[model samples]
Target chain A: MLTIENLYVSINGTPLLEGINLSIGDGETVILFGPNGSGKTTLLYTIMGIGGYEVTEGRILFNDEDITHIPAYERSRKGIGMSMQRPPSIHGLKTRGLVEMCAGKRTVDVEALAKKVNLESFLDRDINLGFSGGEIKRSEILQLMAQRPKLLLFDEPESGVDVENMALVGNMARELLEGPSEPDAQHTLHDLMHERKTSGLIITHTGHILDYITADRGHVLYSGHLCCADNPKRILDHLKKYGYKECIRCLS
Target chain B: MKVDLSKYEFTGHASEKVDDLTRLDKGEKESMKMAGFDASEKNRSASFVQIDHNHAFCKSYDPGVEILPLGLALKIHEGWGDLKWKLLKPEKDEFTRLAADSTHGGYVIRVKKGAKLTAPIQSCLMMHTNKVGQNVHNIILVEEGAEAHILSGCTTTLADQTAAHIGISEFYVEKNASLTFTMIHNWGENVEVRPRSAGQVETGGIFLSNYVSLKPVKNLQMYPAITLKGAGSIARFNSVIVSTENTFMDVGNRVILDAADTRTEIISHAIASGGHIIARGHIQANCSPAKGHLECQGLLLNNGIIQAIPELDGRMEGVELSHEAAVGKIAKEELEYLMIRGMDEEEASSAIVRGFLNIDIMGLPPELKTEIDKAITESEKSMF
Candidate 1:
């Protein structure tokens, strides 16, 4: 559902994403693995239309529509939602309020969403302000659930999340990908699985996501280039055995 | 340059007495009475009844308001009933006894203990002629354990020069009472407005005042003071002002903590776009264990100027006092973030402005909050 061709992005004249190309079909979950400063976040931000990540060359197409120049909120309105690795603290704005705002609805069943993400106690608190690391991750998951976007982008969703709730985040992500299915399932699957229309591009370095969701493919981004695309479990196991040096050598 | 008052005092002069003393004189005292000055006329009788009749003026575009002459007629009637009017026919010992006391205006409104009013009482004053001067006095008395909200708005229709308005207001809050006063002024470009207001609070009473001005005026000055005279009394003042087109605005608030355990807070926010705004706030704690604080924040939208001076004085050793002032343009990072979120430049700026002023509106009534939100939206549209 999303395509990137020869995409080159830079900030302050420093190249971040160089000649990157990738595409994700409907109902596909693609995990991006890269070390720190390997253009993983830059690529996610470029896809999300955040400012300061200028596209010097190439184009990003969402459902075959060129969205290189689309604004961030417009991108959100067009069914592109992202969970930032480091979410911003918005004082005086309740977490539920922001979720409702993003959902484009007047009222929200905040309690249900909070329960889904295990954030019932913090729903009335300021948006991610004064929250612990785990709380922020949970809040991001709640927001993602509220947006219910066509294409979901998760930037380090596992980071700072507690071990116990990490499973909840993973389950929530899987449900979002699978689409809503039954009422009493405890975890409702997304309809995207049946229609094969929803997709996700998750950014991670740990490969821990393999424990929860079924990732279709994995790509290693090194020094601003997509080195390879293969089965996520296989690539992650290979990286664990050989480390990034082998990946870099293979890329060169 | 201290004058010796010991030898300057002399016996009463009979020549100062006028034959027609019974009639209330019209100028300052009459204006005060009209504005609700309630003091007995026995004190300061000479300055009480002097009417500034030459300055009387009125204007109205609507027949109802113009024909009613509510503003002018109210002033005249109030002046006629003030303590100064009684001084004209002083009754020897009785007049002397009353003279020593300060008489507030005649209109006394007392909210019963524990009574709470949800709606705001709105009062409007307007000016229509050039070279016209006005003086008015108002008094409000809130009884023990009561709560009240008062809204006063002023506007001028005339564009003529030399239009002036002088207003005075006094408020009294008994123990455990709470009072909120909101004032909004939108005057013509050439009008000069001066308002002096004071409030006294008894034990456990709370007083909150918010003053907002959105129009460009030739000159505007006001000093609103609150005195926490009872233990556990609390007072808070919040003000916002916007000056444009070479206009000038001078506004401030003074908070005095006179009783032990009293507390006061003052906050002022000003925005200047091609004009000048000067704001000052002072908090004084005179009794032990009293606490006072003053904060002033100013934003310069254009090349215009803004000055804020905040002061705090604590005379008692155990009292606490603090002051803070900040002046700058909107933060660039915040602006860009909002802009990236679909808001244009003007919208971003106004959003921040609205956020800055929304601090106090949280306690306002829903209807008033909606009105302010609409006003901010309209102003944002105009800027765009």
Candidate 2:
């Protein structure tokens, strides 16, 4: 459902992502593994059409629509949603208010949705203000659920979360990527192992997200390039045994 | 009392609205509505709707409280041929004398001992006639162990009417009494207001003053003072002002702690859009074992100007006082963050401005707090 062909991104005239080619088919989920500063975030932001991530030379298509030059908000309106790793705090905007906006035209039971993620108490509070790591992650997931975007982007969902919170985050991410389920529908890891007509591009370095949602493919992004694409288990095993240094060697 | 009006001269000080005392205009009720006053309410009423020195209506709701016209209150409280500016006797300057000398009529509110009045005594003072000076003297007296709440609103009916309002209010909170006074001003663009008020809190008494001015006024200058005269008295001032479209406003609050173990706090939030506002907050701790704190915050939109001056003086050995003041525009990071949440630039800016004005002042009645919040939100919507 999402495709990036020969995407080259620059920030302030400095090349960040160079000639990256990636695609995730309909109902397919992909895992992107990269080390620190390997342009993983740049790729997600470029796809979401955020400012300052200038696409020097590339084309981005979602559902066969060329969205290479669309603005960020328009992209959001066109069913593109992202969960940032470190989203900034909005001083006065309440968490529930943002969720309501994201659920535009959709009669969403926001209170129940927040309660499912144990975020009901925080709905009235300022968005991301003084929230813990686990709380922020939960808040982001709650917003994404409210958005119900056709193509979802997840950035380091497992980072800075505890074991219990990681379980919660992983389960929620799996259900969202699985398809539209009833508000009361309960899905286990086995249910998410089988994919449906919902696509996602997840960025992770530790491969812990694989514990809940089984990805269809995994690609190694090194030095702003998609080095290789292979089976998800093979890539995780390779990274666990040899680390990203092997990927760099392969690139050279 | 003769007021020397040498230094207090302005351009239109020559002509004053003569006492024609025209009947109440329909537009007067509309102006009252703009100031958030409803005439149909029965429990708490606008004891006096004085329109440019005319006593429109007056009433008292309960036996524990007394609301009377200024003329009748003066004659009754002072007896015949007695000079009884007892509580609000003019002192210090010619401005007080001017208010005392040129004032036509005002309202008198009194709460008897041990009376806990839940409903707020509402007062609406409006200006309808053009080129008129509405000068009045108000007195609020709360006897020992009494508790009361007063809501006063001031507004002008016509947008082009050039009027001046000078009011002097004196309050007395007896021992163990508490009084909460809230004043909301919705003035016209060409109106000028000068309100001078002072209160004395006796032992174990509490006095709270909340002021909100939202609409555009030609000029407004007010300095309200409260003296904690008895031991363990407390005083607090919570003010929110929005200056828009080239209006000039200078407002201040002063608290004097004259007895031992007294406490005081002053909080002022000012938002200026193309206008100028200067907020001066002062606290003087004259007795031992007293504490005071002053906080002032200003948000400037566009080319508006704001100056915050917080002064603290501790004369005794055991007095502790602290103050903090900040003035700036909204943070860029906050703006971008809200934009990412699907709010446009204007929506995000208005949200921040409204939040900046929404300060949490302690010990306000829930209904009053809600009213203030609604007013702030409405003002924000109509500002741009």
Candidate 3:
């Protein structure tokens, strides 16, 4: 559903992501593991079409359509949604109001979606205003659920979330990748195999989100380059045995 | 410097336009609807409508509420009314004398003691004659233990007519009474308006004022004052003004907390687009245990001028006073945030401007609040 080829991104003429090639297939979940200053967020923002992240070289194609020069809002309109590591605090914009706008002619049950993220109590408050760390994460997930985008980009979703909220956030993110949930007593196992799926590219630092989500593949980004692509659990075990530097040294 | 009213002195006889009490033309009726004065006549009690120098209509639909002409009210309440006009709006300059002398007619709205009015008293004042100076003197009184709401609107019939409106208003809230006053203005591009007002809140009384001016004007200057004279009284002033074209405005509110445990709050939101605006707020806490806060925020849509002056004075040892003022163009972060939510640049900026102008004042009728929101939205649309 998403493709990038030799993509070089820069901010204000300073190259951040150089010679990068990545892609996420339909219904596939990919985990991106990178250390600090490794341009993980820069890649996400560049793909999301956020301004100030200039694409110096190469192209980005989503669902066979070139979205290299599209604006951020238009990118959202094309079914690309992101959860930021640090979202801004909008003083007068209510969370419910923003979610309603994101729904955009779709009769989505906002209150039910907010309840899934444990943010029902904060639906009426200003967006991200006076919210705790965990609350902010949950609020971001709430908006994503409301958006129901085709390609979901999760940035540090498990960084500040607590264990209790982590379970809820993790469940919601899993539900986003898998199909919607349904409790049934009379259902064949084949019915479960026929569930619809969604595409997701999640960026994780602590990899704690791996406890709840099953990824098809994992890639390590180091020093503005993709270093390795392997099994999700094996790469994690390799990094656990040896730190990021040792992994980068071995890859080099 | 004292204001010289020499050039503003247009004392010639007004054109002989017959006052039609029973007739409202299409344009005049549309103006009234725009001002939120098109409610059913049966829905209104103690209603009045004034166009230029004519007292178009005045009627009382309830016994507890009385509406009368200013001249007749002064004559009837000569001994009992709160007509100490000079004490509140002292004839300190030529402009004051001009308004007091050339005044045609105004409304004197009074609610009897212990009266709880369910419906608001509505008043519509408009300028229809070109080059006519429409001066009015208004007085409102709420007797002890009474509760009332007043909605007053001022507008102009023509967009380019040259006119001037000078009004002097005095309000009195007795002990345990509460009054909510809302004023909306829609003036022409060449009109000048000066509305001088003051209020005195007695012990345990409350006075709330909401003022909005969302139309172009040649020049407008007003500084209304309110004093909490008795113990435990409360006063609040909230205003939103949007100036467009070549309009110039100098508006402010002053509050004095003189009794023990009294509280006052002054808030204003000013928007200037291709115009000049100087928003001023002043608050003084004079007695022990008194509290006051003043906030003024200005949004400049262009290179047009905007100045916010906030002054706070605390005299007594236990008095607490604070002021916060800000004036700037729209923030890029705020604009981009809205864009991320799917609005274009123009839509995002206008939404922020509208939200900035939205002040949550308490105790307004839902219908009135809707009207006020509609007016603000209309002004926001004209900004871009």
Candidate 4:
């Protein structure tokens, strides 16, 4: 569903990411492990078409459509959604209203959805205004639930959440990647198992999210290059045994 | 500089009084509506409607309220003569001099003691003559333990009318009383407006002022001052202005906290969309235990100028005074965040502007709040 071939990205004429080739097929979820300032967010922002992230070489193909140079809004309209690590707090823009906007033409019961995340009181509050770290993460999941994009880019879903809220965010991330716990009448149980097609590229550090959602494939992003391709849990175990420095041998 | 009053006629376009405001033509009523007047009169306890140089209508429906024109109030009430120009000096400026020289028609509204009316009193000063020089002097008195709100709308009846309006207003809130004055201005493109106003609050009194001007005015300037003369008195000024092409405005408010425990807050939101605006705010605390704050923020949509001047002064050692002022365009991160939520550039910008000028914090009644919302929407059309 998504493809980045030899992606070379930079900001302010300084190269931050180079020779990055990655793809997430339909119905596939990928977990990326990287150290801080290792061009992890730069890659995600470049994929999302955010400004100031200049794609110097190569291109990004989403469902075979060339969207490397398109604007961020256009990418959002083309079934790409991103949960920023630290999104700006827009004054006067209510969380409920923004969730509804994310749904576009589709109708969304905002209050009902907000209740699922225990964010009923935050629905009327300004977006991310004075929100705690856990509240922001839950709000991100709530917005993504409304967006219903084919491919989701979650940046550190468990970063700021407490151990109590981590379960909610992780399980919600699973629901976003896979279908809900129960399928609707339109899809049979057999169809649900085979036809579900939402994809994801989640960034996580501790791999504690693995306790809730199962990741199909994992890769360590070391020095802007994807290396150490293996099972997500095995990669997590390897990184725990020896930090990101040991993964540099895989680059050689 | 003195206004060239000779360029406009002060008389000869006499208009007859209308018993009912709804009987007016659609365009005239629309012009008044844009300025926050309610033609239906459903949400008002009393009303005062004036055409150019005529107090066409002035009446009070609630028995607890009394309304009278300036001419009648000065003659009938024995102590009202001492109230005129009491808070504001007639020689303060040329505009005040003109208003004092010929009081075309202004109203004096007084709420009786211990009366708290649910509905507001609406007053519309509409100028219809082509080049009429309209002048008015208004006064409001809230007795002890009484509470009242006044919604005043001033406008020219024509979109391109070349007229001039000069208004002088003085309000007095007695001990333990509450008074809220909300003024909306929708003058035409060629219209020049000058409003001079001042107020005083007694012991334990509360004074709240809300000013909104979203339409075009060639030249406009006003700076109303309120003095808290008694202990525990409080005052706040909330102003939102949107100036478009060919418009120029110099508007602000000043509050003086002279008594112990008195507090004041002055906040203004100014937006310049290809026009020039000078937004000013000042607060002074002269006694211990007094507190005051001033905030003036400006947003520039395009090629225009926005000057925000906020001043705070403290006289006594125990007094607290502070201020914050900023003038710039919308933050880039704020715009991009909205755009990625599925809205295009224009839609995102409009949302930001509406939020920047949001009036939900002003505590306006439902009727006047709807008027300000409509004005914000209309002003958005000129921005893009």
Candidate 5:
């Protein structure tokens, strides 16, 4: 479970996210719908404890504990993982090496993970260096799958991903939410699928994510304010029909 | 049939021909003599061989080898005579000044064409007095398709004294030949070293020189050049200099590409602590389709100074030239990360420094690489 009470974030003394309040229950997926510059990234970075974003006046509670000042790596070690929108290219650090590092296990079967994510050919290459857009996205997913965090944050995962790999990524996302059913099997196809206790908060602007997985609830974030929380299909259809103009008008 | 110049102001009168006939003036007769052909004694052609006053104590470990001081005739008669050494001096005016005051120990080494010499040609110059001076000349002529590896080292044993060591080494890599020249210098704290070395490579030849300095002297000024004159020739220069304790080092390396499809590469590394180092590297591609590359990197440990200047000059439009120079201290994150991984601060720092220096040494021969690694490790232990 995650909770934020009156979160305020600013960059260079300019307010980006003002008086934001939200919460997510256990095993629940929350979709954050907002237009450009609506503090979506700032909010995600604030929750993930990145970007050096100062929490002017707010408290972030994770699993009923105050973790507002936790560092990124510590937060990651505490069952919190984030898939960045644009990951940094780390030279000489192989993808498998990073997976093993983040997994914190020397005996991790990296070859299997690579094969699962279709990155088996590039396992020995540098981490995300010269990888295509889709390959980078898949690498992010592979890292998340290895981390197996309790609360996952996806920052625009749909951006720049081609249609051919979108289904595989979408299915992987679905499988990560469900628990692994058969643990004794050699290949853990259902391992990520059976892990049902994991929750996620996805940020999307195009609303094309509605075709992939079932979002439990949707919240419209406009002008640094959470206007309303409703059904995912209803909100996505409303945004598709009227855009953010109507949402801003409703806020006024 | 020659006209006299009565109105001209001659700086110095031309001397008579002495025991050395290899120092003929720039003319057809000199060319013929350089090609090992006998000249007509009837014409009485004049030769200018200006021998210096400083005597070179000559001795050879092998009985078949001959070591001469600074005479060109003894050098030629002993089968060490090749025309390449004559062209290494500066112009006439500059050559005279250097020759008159230069203390040169001239050694001629001749490996027959296709002959392989396993033993390195070793030489040493001892500056035993304060304000001592040394100018050593070494000529190594590897005939066509021959191969050899020469190891030359210079050092000073005494302390609290000022000394100068100027060595001029000329190497001729003939057609289809290969040569590796490794020069290591560990001068004392008060010695000043000015080494001007040059080498010329003929067609299908390879010349590689690796220069490394561990200790810091008072001053070091070196400009070593290699000219690739024949097509498909290659020249490579790898140099590393470390200075500390108020030392000043000025090092330069240049490679000239004169024939088509020639290739040249130069890599320099400088590490300074409580001193200053100036490294200049240049690669000039004058012929079409030639390739030139230059890389110079410096690491400053303490408040000492480092100046890296790398230049690439291309005259032909079809040539490729690239140059890169970086000067900075060790990265803090990398240092901290290495420290956290069970290495002490000194160990971590030395590891970082060794990594920086051994980057180019990675692709060297295994034996040479092991020697370099051992040398750096010993130096690092001594520094700590």
Candidate 6:
């Protein structure tokens, strides 16, 4: 669903991401683990086509179409959506109205959807204004659900959320990637596979998200390089024991 | 600032009286309706209509409220002298001087003591003749334990006809009384306006003022102040002004928290599209346990300019006063946030501007609310 070849990103002539090649197949969800200032966010933003992240030398393809030169808004129109970690607060723009806009041509029952996230009372309020950490995450998930994009990018969904909110956000994130389903018993890693589903690229630092949902693969971004395409649990276990330096020294 | 007193003819514009406002012609009625005056007087307890320098219509439908012309009220009520030009002195400026000397027709609206009139009283000051200078004095009194609302609309008869309006209004909120005054200005592009207004609130009284001006005007300058003189009194001011192309506006508000436990607040939103606007607010807390807050925000859509001045003055150590002022274009982050939601740049900017102008006031009539929404929509069309 997504492809990148030799992605070289720079900000005002300062090199940020260099010589990066990554691909996520249809119905595949890739987990990216990176330390602070490891170009993880730069990679996601470059994929989303945000300003200030100039692509000096690279080509980004989604569904076999080159979208490297498209604007951020055009990328959104082309079924690419992002859940930013720290979204800006837009005063006077109600959250419900934005959710409806995110739906596009699709009709959405906003009140019913807001009830799923316990945001029924916050529909009329300005989006992201004075929202708590958990509320912000849930609001982001709610927007993505309404948008129903084919390719979803999650940037640190576990940050700033408590355990209770984490459970809710994780389940919601799962439902967004895989189509919605009725309440059922917990699924093991064996039941995580699907023939065709929404594609996702999630950025994580703690890897606590691995306990909630299944990931196709886990890769570490170190010094602007992708390394160690292995099982999600094995990579997390190795990072917990040996840290990222071992992966950089051997896995690359 | 360059208004010539001799250029406008103050006399010979005395309009004939009309007992029923519905009898007026279609054009005049439409213009007045745009200024928030309902010719049929629907949802209004009382009304006063003044054309040029004449009192065309004045009446009261509710027994609890009294509607009288300023000239007649002064002749009958001897105590009018004490209330006239009491809060704002006539020697302060040329506009006040003209209003005091040539005092034409204005309204004297008074709510009886202990009376609570749920419906608002309406007043329309119209410039029907060419280059007419309308100088008027208005007084509003909400007696003890009374609650009242007054909606005043000021406008010119035609879009391009030149006119000038110099008005002096004094308000008094008695003990335990509540008064909400809403003013809407739909002036012409060639009109100049100078309004001198001041109010005083007594013990346990509440005074809320809302001013909205959406139409174009050549020049406008006003700074209305309200003083909380007694303990437990509260005052709030909300204003939304748009300076369209070729217009210049210098508007502000001042609130004084004088006694212990008194509170006051001022909030204003100004938009400049190919025009200039200077938005100012000042809050002064004099006594201990007093609180005052002021917020002024301005949005510049084009090459137009905006200047926001918010001042805070604390007379004593125990008083709390704060202010916030911001003047700039829209934030890029906010725009991108909307764009990601499938809105283009133009649609996103329009939504932001509309929201910026949507200020919530206490007692806004439905008609006025619709007018404001229409005004915002109309202005946004020209902006993009």
Which is the leading candidate under TM-score? Answer: 4
Query: Which lDDT tens digits does candidate 5 get at residues B1-384?
Result: 111222221222222323333343334233222211222322221111122223323333333233444465354575455443564664433322453354344455555688655544443344444555555566677779877665555645455656666667788889988887767676678776767677889999999888777776888777778899999999988887778867899897989999998998898878887678888988888998899888888878777689887888899899999988878887654443333222345755775677566534423334445655666776675445
Task: Write one digit per residue (lDDT tens) for candidate 5, span A1-252.
Answer: 899999888878888888888998878888998998888878887887767578888889999988888765556667777777777554345677667655655356878877877999887776667988778878887777777778878887788888888776776776565544445656465654444687888888776666777779888888778777988788888988988888878888
Put down candidate 4 lDDT per residue, A1-252, tens digits, no spaces. 999999898889988888988989998889999999888888888888775788889999999999999888888898888888898887677898889988989999999888988999999888999998899999988998898888899899888899999999888888888877677888778877786688989899999888988788998888877787789999898888889778777677
Displacement of the residue A240 alpha carbon in candidate 3, Å? 6.4
Per-candidate total of colliding backbone pairs: 28, 0, 0, 0, 9, 0
Question: After superposition on all CA atoms, what RMSD does each candidate show versus the true structure?
Answer: 10.9, 5.4, 3.5, 2.0, 13.0, 2.7
lDDT of 1 by residue, A1-252 (tens): 899999999999999888999999877899999888999988988888875689999999998999998777677767787777776554345666566655665466768988887888887676667887778877877877777788988888789878887887777877777665454445434433455456899987777767888889999998898988899888888888887898778887
Per-candidate TM-score against the hidden true structure: 0.70, 0.81, 0.88, 0.95, 0.61, 0.95
lDDT winner between candidates 1 and 5? 5
Question: A138, model 2: CA deviation in Å?
Answer: 3.2
The residue-level lDDT of candidate 2 at A66 comes to: 92
Q: Where does candidate 6 chain B have its weakest 10-residue lDDT segment?
A: B354-363
Restricted to chain B, the TM-score per model reads 0.70, 0.88, 0.92, 0.97, 0.76, 0.98
Instruction: Using lDDT as the measure, name the better of candidate 3 and candidate 5.
Output: 3
- For model 3, the docking class works out as acceptable
Local error of candidate 5 at residue B82 (angstroms): 3.5
- Candidate 3 stretches greater than 4 Å from native: A35-38, A89-92, A111-126, A183-197, A220-252, B1-22, B42-45, B80-82, B359-377
Error of 2 at A238 (Å): 5.9
Candidate 3: true contacts recovered, fraction: 0.31
**What lDDT does the true structure give each of the candidates?**
0.66, 0.79, 0.80, 0.87, 0.68, 0.87
lDDT of 4 by residue, B185-292 (tens): 988789988899889999999999988899889889888999999999999888888899989999999998989999998988889999899988888888989998
Q: Write candidate 3's Cα lDDT for B1-384 as tens digits.
A: 133345443565343432453367778766665565653544555678877775677887788798987877778887645464744555665566776667777788989999888877888887887777787878898999999888888887876888888888889999999998888787878888888888889999999988878878889998888999989999988888898869899999998998998999888888898789998888888898999999888888766788888888888898889988878888766665656556667866766776677655445556656776787777776678
DockQ per model, Cα: 0.18, 0.32, 0.45, 0.68, 0.04, 0.60
Instruction: List the candidates ranked by DockQ, beginning with the highest.
Output: 4, 6, 3, 2, 1, 5
